[model samples]
Target: MAKYKLPKPGELSSSINYNPPAKDWMDIPVEFKPATYPAAAKEKDLLTVGFPNAHQWTPEDEDWNLPDGWEDTVIKGIEERLSKYRSFKLFMDVCVRCGACADKCHFYIGTGDPKNMPVVRAELLRSVYKRYFTKAGKVLGRLAGARDLDADVLKEWWYYFFQCTECRRCSVFCPYGIDTAELTIMGRELLNLLGLNINWIAGPVAACYSKGNHLGIEPHALKSNIELMIDDIEDITGIRVNPTFNRKGAEILFVTPSGDYMGEPGIYTCMGYLMLFHELGLDYTWSTYASEGGNFGFFTSNDMAKRLNSKIYAEAKRLGVKWILGGECGHMWRVLNQYMDTWNGPADFLEVPVSPITGTRFENAKSTKMVHITEFTADLIKHNKLKLDPTRNDHLRVTFHDSCNPARGMGLFEEPRYVIKSVCNNFFEMPENTIREKTFCCGSGSGLNATENMEERMRGGFPRANAVKYVHDKHGVNMLANICAVDRAAFPALMDYWVPGVGVTGTHELVANALVMTGEKERTTNLRGEDLPGKEGNE
Candidate 1:
């Protein structure tokens, strides 16, 4: 029952210069005090009396030395590079300081902090940029609250920049469409350049660079995992199927995320891909060479992103595939739809995927002529190509959580919803503002998937869970469905914290679970009418 105040519709502007009186210290709320650092007694009581907890931590050890030449060169380089953009200039010039973006931020809403305002959050980096790069800032010095490089400022940048999930929820309501997400991305990229990346992100980035996949799963491990998933698919569907691996000269290259190969939720979606493709008699190959489509580099640097995406093009070329199907992933689709076509691919050898069943052409499809699995499935259902049992998903009442990357980054709203509705009869929707483009984050997207930020993650998850709680109260939404791997990896933890019984799963899991065996397995009164062999009326 969090009360959220919406911004007055037409009042967004940075230049309005309307300032409220400073807070009266006498009348200040006790809850509004800054969180004090915990004392030694509190820390000792909280600490587990174990071998690891015996070691004392110091402030000097807590803060590391600055990178070589960071202050003189790298920092200035980023400030200069980002300064040249008129878009960045528009962002600086147009934000009306109306605080329209204030309550819209989950971090602010959860913390009730005025400084966590999206505009104020961007100011963390924006202030640095202004001080170093702008004329007004150069002349004014500390008057504009800008300062030169110091360890403290850099540390603050690391903290606040990472606080942003880059969900773009704030940008949706911005009058000038000023994206704080982009600023946060730039801030993170700049910090990453100085070797300031968080452990969780740095580990994955390094793993992606050296090993063709993140999670450090090697090619053989990846193949074995895929094989295991294929076995599970067979166990459930009673269809003995081997999903092709690294098959040269295949007509289509299905590029799923490494997460699907390595983790749950996504792995189920991977199995669904195997079943659907096998049913359609499609010729496709899974390439270990281009094992990952989920790029963390998108949250970091564009250059590093290109380095990551180069694999997709390289693998497609090596396999000689006509098209590559991107699996159910959010950022992967964002990179594929927005940047991959232009960044690292011509994909000249590929053909625009024409539905062989309908003769409809997929045009302007940039890299490897990509098609989202949901879109492909929806089109098949549209053409009366797949025989499905719409009532199979009735056991679980489901609500769709449209991932921000797919919903706003790409206009992929209806396709997934259509696929969901076609496969599951009892599908429900959350509040309108909390779905589609206005959807809140699962609190772990855009690299906040870091294990270190559990408390922050819960705070960020508040808005989405509040929305889900409302939906569950009214419509009994038993499970939350989304396509993003980050969402899958993140929401279960949040559900455990906020609403104990509620569950989260991939969209494809619901579809694949509900898939009719032979499309006529004796339609029952409830859900699980004609599911796989051992799955009927069972968990």
Candidate 2:
């Protein structure tokens, strides 16, 4: 149990101040106020992944129990990373302090904390880089904006780095294209070296390392969970969906975030997958071994991310499936698009993905050999492969939230909208600035979606919620649709706090809602068991 409690919306919104104070940002010391941040990683969770200096500690304590020569470890880690990644080095060296990205961060807009500005957040690390690595800093000191790395500075790094969602919205605006998310990644990596990780992130990393999923769900439990969803699909549509697990010789190996296996609204999306696959008669099998598509290890370090990501290709080869089909997850697609091929390799064992229903070859994913679900569904809609009745979802006026990673990380902009519009009749976009590549984060991303950090999540999500409020007021929007599992999990709480009447949903859930399955009984309700607009009286 945590000490933090969420405040009333009025009080919470009133507390924010967007303007910076008269004092310099450097002089503003880090504060460990209760409820503002998440708890420290437990020793057991840290030990599960063999993180060094694993010990019980709290951020509020005066002594953080850092290992001896911890400063040397962080400095060496920075040096090694700077040499290994050219982009990191370029980001460290090329910043002109132009402030082009200052206002782009959601946290800066919500909380008005100057350090939350992407530029200042990077400077927290860049200043340390200057003091230890740069010659100019060795001579000029303060004039060069160099600062010593001490206990306070390390605490500041932990405080601010976790505040970032690593959405890359700021990078989209940077002239030098500085990825502040990468900087936060580096900061978290350095922190993990000292076992200074939050429980939400460290727990999932450890679970995914050993149990193949973030929830630590075992093979049997994973099967049972999907089985439960199968039963629900039968009740709603009067058609039982039989999905195989860990079955070899399947044409496609389907992978989705484990949240979709059980979490609300996400499970409906999972039901959507089951319904759609049955309709197409697609030869796909679910893998308990590669049960998770979302990677929390990506938030920890490069090595950990690689270690967890290696499972997918390994399962694909073991099951002898062709190319993989990924579900509606944000960072998962980012990892698959950018890092997986580089970390895991050419995936030469897998063939380029060709949709069995539409026969559309995904040339963009030829190297990774994995296709996003929206890309597959959009192709089906484009080819008129599936029988869709958009009127089924007429009760809901919907708006699309372009998830952070998919939009900016992979440039997956139009595919999901195409799918959503094809399934739901009343489709509306969030304000232009808030959608597509320049979209805002759900604030709970990058492993910050913990109970104790509720205040920060709400504050960081304010800009996005504000935009939703805009559409809600004007168009009577009732449901928020997105592709990310994190968005599915996070936005329900976000909308409840900010825009109460609006509900959160997945794109595939919308697809399944409108999908007219063959031999299905007379449908009285949507996948969620809610009656359709005109079917309410019939039910």
Candidate 3:
């Protein structure tokens, strides 16, 4: 739990100040407050993932207990990455510091911290890059905006890099199109070399590595969780959905974040998936081995991300599933669309995904050989393959939130909206500036959604909550729909803190609510056991 209680909405909102302070950003030292940042990664979690310098340390202590030659390790890690990724070097070199990205970051908008500005955040690393890697920086020193890589600078890197959600909204505004998120990724990678990682990220990475899911749910436990959802489906619809796990020769392999099965609200979304699959008579199987669709390792380092992501393809091949259907998640799709092929490529064993129901080939996913659930559902709705009763969601005045990875990384704008409008009677959009490619992060993304950092999470989520408040007040929106699991887990707290009464849900939960399944008894209550609009008396 957070050490301090969050202020009321009025005081918190009134506390934001966008103005920069009198001193240069470099002159300002980072203060390690208890609740403002996430806790340091535990030694055991670091050891589980084979990270270096496995030892106990707190961010507040002057001694971080870095291993001998830790500075050399970070410098060499930066040099290796500079030599490897062209984008890293290009981003380091190309920023003109025009301040176009200063106001664009949600963290900057909410916290009013100058270092949270994307340009300045990138400069935190670029300063070291300039001092060590560039001739001009080596000659001119501070004159060229270069600073030495010292312990204080490393601490600053740990603080601010973890502060970022890696949402990439800043990259959209940059004239040079510098991806500040990738810069943060690189910064985190360097930090990982010295075993400087947050518990929120490292714990999940370690769990996903050994237990095959972020929650460390064992194979039998994973099956039990789904079976519980199956039982609930029976209770709601009077229809039994028997989903297979680790079954061989299935036509499609279904993968979703473990939260969808294990966590509240996300479990409702999981029920939606089971109901939809049962109605379609689709041939799909779940894998306990590839249980987690989200790759928390992406928040740690690229190598760790690849290590965690390899399980999906491995499971797909072993099961002999013809194609893969992914559930709603933010960074999972980013990894799939952008980095998966490069990291664990070819997916030669699996066939290109074709909707068994609609017969529409997913040409977009031909290479990745995996299709998003919304893309699959939108196609089904397009062909009128499933009967739907939109009024089941009449109780919800719904608005769609575009998860950052899908909107920016994958260009998935209309499919989710199309699905949402088809299922719900009343659908509204947040301000155009706060949606689609320009969407604000849910604030607790990229493993920043830890309980210890409640204040920070609330601060970062303010811009997004403000946008939701607009539609909530104007359009009477009661439910916020999104495709990301992190949004499902993060938004409830955000809404409670910032805009009370706006509930969060996944897209498919609404879909299943509106789905008119074959031979289903009168659904008096929706999946959450809430009464339908006119069926209130019956429930």
Candidate 4:
């Protein structure tokens, strides 16, 4: 008998009865529209920066201009990666299908698509592994839940794999510790072999390869933008802070996502860094060369991730700094904590990162020698080093959105919240399940933040926005602060769409506003130039 029996069309069914579950994997079909894919990687963007494997193609057309024997390329690529990484092999073999991780996926939960289920998404790749590598699948075929690789399977792989954000939320609930992100990266690597990549990912990666930063901002341009920020700092604090660039013998080298220097929420965070460093009189220099802490190639392939990550350590050694201090970012920290030491290590040229201002040593990042900005600020608050007036933020009610990577990948949970609480008296957290280790993605991570996939982003982002709505209604929260660049860039749109009137901001922006700078005029406006709650009509 079929495990699932359908009710007759237009017929009423028992309202309180439980439905049967599917017994066969083949019973489902997966398909997606063109909007589900990222914008096609442009040849000009790739060629301008001379990215390897540069090709001319768009997903709008049927023929992808794939190289000869592309099928052999993907299958062989999988075979090679399986042998190289034992984690891949073990993850491929062990799965009891108890379904603990199935419901944990945001894509599956939001869209209700079966393929978005984490276990099923991994099975798309594992089924092919079974057919080619395992004896049971080779003999039993479909009955053993294995299928032959073909164009249809390849298409399905691209559609579903790109849907994932590599957030690793499912792994937290899995019994066997099966991480779907590992499979997502592997699938992307194999797809890259065929030159199948999204434009938002490939473009930034290519720009970072040649220009030394994403958005292809040049050396003098980075300085110009920074000087503009400095002008703003002087206007507020009556202090003109000047940070060095590529200067050797500095005590520390500060690296953050290139997005920080750009306008909006990120630029304010950059100002926060500048003001805090000036307050402590810290010795540090910025590098126009290793300007970007984020690695978009991480969204593409591991080898590319390593190549981009190498510049940080190389620049540190060149500048003769003690250690590296990274700014507000999500995947940037993930790479630093999980993969930086492994990919490019022996940062023996640098000393351990100890907060000279607070005297706190980051033991978690001792091996990699990188410290997060929030960690540094939290320590200062713990030691009561900063003179802060939390009442400056009395006009706003704040809530925090834990960006997916730092929450799940690294478990760096409490540092940012501690800093926020120390600075703002009116802070509220979202629902318990919607935060911390179980946080939802901004719906546009892993380089899927393209306009073409806005619909998909909206669908995936609904879960997080829905949680924000709950708190906004309950706690009257008008500010939704986070610590990631993508969160700052993407949350504004998500908030506007799902829960209007909720503004997005970086954690440091709040910290900077509440700080009391010495010998400065009495503050009347906060960072965004909004009037201080009760300090209105002041000069």
Instruction: Give the local distance difference test score of model 4.
Output: 0.87
lDDT of 3 at 115: 92
**Residue 506 C-alpha lDDT in model 1:** 78
Estimate the Cα RMSD of every predicted model relative to the unseen true structure. Answer: 10.1, 5.8, 5.8, 5.6
Per-structure clash totals for the candidates: 4, 0, 0, 0
**Per-residue accuracy of model 3 over 1-539 as CA lDDT, tens digit each:** 66998799999878997765689889999998878899999999999989888899999999988888987998899999999999999999999989999999999999989899998999999999999999989999989999999999999999999999999999999999899999999999999988899998899999999999999999999999889988888998999998999999999999999889778789999999999999999999999999999999999888899999999999999999998999999999999999999899899898889998988999999999999999999999999998999999988999999999999999999999999999998999999999999999999999999999999999999999999999999999989999999999999999999999999999999999999999999999999888988998895
- The lowest-lDDT stretch of 10 consecutive residues in candidate 2 is 19-28
Tens-digit lDDT string for candidate 2 (169-268): 9999999989999999999999999999999989988999999999889999998998998888888889988899988999999999988988798899
lDDT of each: 0.72, 0.93, 0.94, 0.87
Q: List the residue pairs that clash in candidate 1.
A: 13-96, 14-95, 14-96, 14-97
* Residue-wise C-alpha lDDT for candidate 1, range 420-486, written one tens digit per residue: 8887777789888888988888777777776656877888889998888887888888888888888
Q: Estimate each model's TM-score.
A: 0.84, 0.96, 0.96, 0.93
User: Residues 1-539, candidate 4, lDDT per residue (tens digit)?
Assistant: 66887677545554555764575555554455757778777777656544446688766566667777887888899999999998899999998888999988888888988788999999999999999889999999987888998767777787788899988889989999988899999998888777777789989998899888888899999999999999988877788888889999999999999989896889998998988888888999999999999999898788889999999999999889999999999999899989999999989877888988878888887899999888888999999999998998888799999888888878878999999999999999999999999998888888887888888888888899999999999999999999999888888888999999999889999998988877767777876777788877776
Q: How close is candidate 2 to the true structure, as a TM-score?
A: 0.96
The residue ranges of model 4 lying beyond 4 angstroms of the native Cα positions read: 1-34, 44-53, 537-539
Taking all chains together, the TM-score of candidate 1 against the true structure is 0.84
